[model samples]
Target chain A: MQKRISIFIFLLVHIASINAQEAKMASIKEGSFVPLYGASSKKPTVVKSFFLDVYPVTNEDFLNFIKKNPSYSKSKIKGIFADKSYLAYWKNNFDFGSANPKSPVTSVSWFAAKKYCECQGKRLPTMEEWEYAAMADEKRIDARTKTEFNTYILSWYEKSKTYENTIGSTFKNYWGVYDLHGLVWEWTSDFNSIFLSGESRKDKNNDKNLFCGSASVNATDLMDYAAFMRYAFRGSLKANYSTRNLGFRCASTTKY
Target chain B: MKKITLAILIILSMQSCKDNTQNKNVTKEKPISDLSIYNLPSQWTNQDGKNIELKSLKGNVLVMVMIYTSCKAACPRLVADMRSIESKLKPETKKNIKLILVSIDPETDTPQRLKSFAIENKMNQEPWIFLRSTEENTREFAAVLAVNYKKITPIDFSHSNIISVFNPEGELIYQQEGLGVNNDETVNKINQEAEKIR
Candidate 1:
């Protein structure tokens, strides 16, 4: 009788893991758009068809992740991979505490988030893929130009402690993805590609000495100040650093 | 017989639960500092096509820079800067230091290409190593170095000009940012770090 129960438990755990590995995701179609940074202003970067998580990764999902990958657990994590504040809100390695189980996980470093996605057999979205999917509002594919669209994002930026909110509380975009803007900032696979800030200065406006090809890749639309803020935020980040208002979701080239 | 099978099954499931973390954290040496680059688990191939991990290079002070062999704009000057730093080092310090050029454009800068570039640049000798890895690993490595780069065209990349110095323990000690900047501070730091290594 004990042998039968053990076999049943094994099968149950295996199925549960398999389901976690394949979470809810939205299929994003391929298209082209000029981003606020990283390409020549006149040129549009093409995004291949991909899958994105419908919502940001929640504290519940991440707890499952750390249970399996304990090297990333709070105590065992190498200092090179994450900063001191990583998962600071969680009570311990196994529990996220009184924070809502369904709330989006925050204070995760780029390395931890990257590993979480890789273990899922997926990868983090490129900055371009992220910006492309995020360009949509509830009704339109390209809504950056709309006053209401920009206002909503800008207001979310003004709002304090939105990271405490649950995922999918925000409106779904054109691609059926949620919380691209209203939730915490996310880590991109190539967030380091952006070049702005201290590198640019007087007479250094096109500082070829500090960075290569900076002259040609100015912001395509200065009016999209909202996107510019995201680019600047990415520029300021180091991979090992984590914060209370930062979180991430996985993306994949193939549908699961 | 059923009892034996179930025991094996329980053991197997426990091992599987530990599988993900086991593949990483390959090195458990107590002395390796938490901030050391040796903690990175990625594998890399050198100009000679030998597989290496950052931990294997632990005993030498590392003077590392990221560049693509194909870069025409800043890498040539960066290469000159690296050579200049090497030239100024004392023979004793040279014994303890390795000047490394890591490739950001791994897709095009194959081991063969790196070998030829090393030969052409007259860097195919002691203390100069060229390394490349998978694109994902390269990105992760770049993140560690805080070196930012992007491909502007099919054949060209835009990258920052930075040379990072790490102590023998694989902890980053100093960084020289910008092209053709003063190397006095960098060389002194390298000498100072190398002196401690011996």
Candidate 2:
């Protein structure tokens, strides 16, 4: 009888251990605001309430993911979903050498980041949600007009190798989210939706005829050069492209 | 002893099922090239409501664009661009090509809608394929094609105007950007690829 009782306890513990640990998330109340893009013209866009991770995804978290989904490991991942440098920094499939485990995992492609979120039953935040949450300073929800807020972000852009820093190492925002500005650039679900200046000759013709309805889209706030940098960075990304300073976090719609 | 053996067999069968599903295409075909789009595993539905995988179109040269049936602006010219490309191709090479238009708005563009659009555009004949899948797969496919798109209103979307060509092995070979640009280069590339299959 004692042996039988012990066996039951062991089975319960084993089953619990099999499940992946859930990441902590903060609740963001739904609100409306006009971001630089995504709104109809320059009108306000309504962002429904969602939950977002407090910090960017860390190297340790991704390591746990690849353990369960071996197909996504650096050596085995399909070429269509990621480029040759998907996890160039990782020393091996299960090991991340010389890099801090708590630092945000960079050099991950959009497809790889999307898969990571899905495995956790979460998804990458839409661009509106990301921009909405990011606009906040430590005190105010919308700080685009604040000179200090814009300056701080621009300074971080000038900083080198901030991706090597640990997550949650920067100031917490009004939404209780951390490292939104000072860490690394993140991938959004709709990152490809952006259309910047018709810089290229191909795009010059495309803007007139190829993208017929895009005449309505223009920079809503040219003074907010920090936001413009983010939009331009998103515009340049292809799904399979990965860089050393690019990472992402997960978000989910909140249910009452 | 008998019960334990039976339990083990059940567990083994479940493992086999998982493996078969994951390796479904990899095992049947020669190893897919690292750069081939056929490596994608997402399932899609064609205009006829038949479910198919991208791998099924492996043997033909592919000319693909992303557009919705409801677009008021760029999609029409994009479609016209595709049609003009097809008209310019040599009659012999046309037999070995498939011009696919994947819908960015899957919610509104059903298989029936796609089929009707095909008929309305006089593209109901051979070598014209219309495909729509779940929204997630659509975004992923757009990413692969470097096609940017966004829904602006209930019935309209703004998207990049680019047409891509793929060789018979599902590797991207050439891309023609912008609207109504010269098709001579695109046509030459298509002819060259088709020549290889002949």
Candidate 3:
């Protein structure tokens, strides 16, 4: 009887654990996705998924990063890090005594932005992922009518404001991601890489060599025709360059 | 036996859930497309110093080229290429399409300088505009359009010599590379792209 009771208790415990595990998995599986525009179609031909940031990284968040990683601090930085644009606004505007630490950190270089995400055990979203998230919802499509999106995007270039309050202070995108297209231009991990040429949808075999130059003749030929021009454009930007409009967000793979 | 069965079922359910979660996190990837070069950043000043934004050019098709007044090598050829294309357009098509030359050298390419550059190129026409912006704004704008440029020295610059075409709605429709190419072929391509928007 004692043995039987022990076995029964064990079974009950295992069942509860299993149920909990199942619930966790379900939540992760329900990840959000945004779609990309096709050549001939107005609607997205492909869907790209990403994380939903409740808010942009605040000044406090960046300060914490600096505290943890001394290398990124003003003193330890070198070479491209020495550019005036790197910390011009942030250093001048930030008031340690009065500034809101929770505000999103601005005036950071693309390299620094990447390092910040790495410290947090997260990664920046790729440009494709960023665009997909921005245009996720059908309902939001009407809002982003050519006129409105153009106007909104252009306005940022015209006006010159030093600091914004925080990330969520502005409008949110379709996937509930805040300040994607507006508040600041977030940095992406693959923003500067030359993407593998070729149609993303048709190439199902996932050829790694296509990314490099040494792929098979067939693959190279396929890539030359299928690759988009935007990839080439991204490759043009030098890493040392920094601008006021640039900022970043973090993403982590869902641990199962 | 009943307890054993229950335990096995729960474990299997848990494993299935984990797999589903992993699947959900995996985002769908897609190929990027060739975006129009004209869909660049906004609020650029024309050669005449008028504030021009992409939206403001909504009614007419636009042909865009990048130049700096200080450039001695490519700017002349680029302007000549644009003129050659303009000459080939039909009277009605010419009336509909606007030619724009944006200055990558914002610091030195002032309104007066841009105007003189246009005059020297004999591009003093209805649609031609020489544009300039602040250093910060221009760099951001250049990045958006993927127009690579660097100060080879203080006075001279090296930049990608590409011309962009925009539709009436300000979407980047097409791009032509380099200054000198098959002029007739280029003109035909431009006219064909312009007609789509018209």
The lDDT of each candidate is 0.87, 0.86, 0.55
Runs in model 1 deviating more than 4 A are A1-12, A199-206, B1-31
Give the chain B TM-score for each candidate. 0.87, 0.88, 0.74
Candidates in order, TM-scores: namely 0.91, 0.90, 0.40
lDDT by residue (tens digit), candidate 3, A173-200: 5545566545665665555423333433
lDDT of 1 by residue, B79-138 (tens): 999999999998876899999999999999999999999999999998999999999999
How large is the interface RMSD of each prediction? Answer: 4.3, 5.1, 18.9
What is the DockQ for all candidates, taken in turn? Answer: 0.50, 0.43, 0.01
lDDT of 2 by residue, A92-149 (tens): 9999999999999999999889988876668899999999999999999999999999
lDDT of 1 by residue, A203-249 (tens): 23336777876666678889998998899888888999899999999
* Candidate 2 TM-score over all chains jointly: 0.90
The top-ranked prediction according to DockQ is 1
- Per-model RMSD to reference: 3.5, 3.8, 24.0
Off by over 4 Å in 3: A1-256, B1-41, B196-198
Q: What's the ranking of the predictions by DockQ, best on top? A: 1, 2, 3
Q: Clash pairs of candidate 3?
A: A29-B21, A58-A103, A58-A104, A59-A103, A60-A101, A198-A227
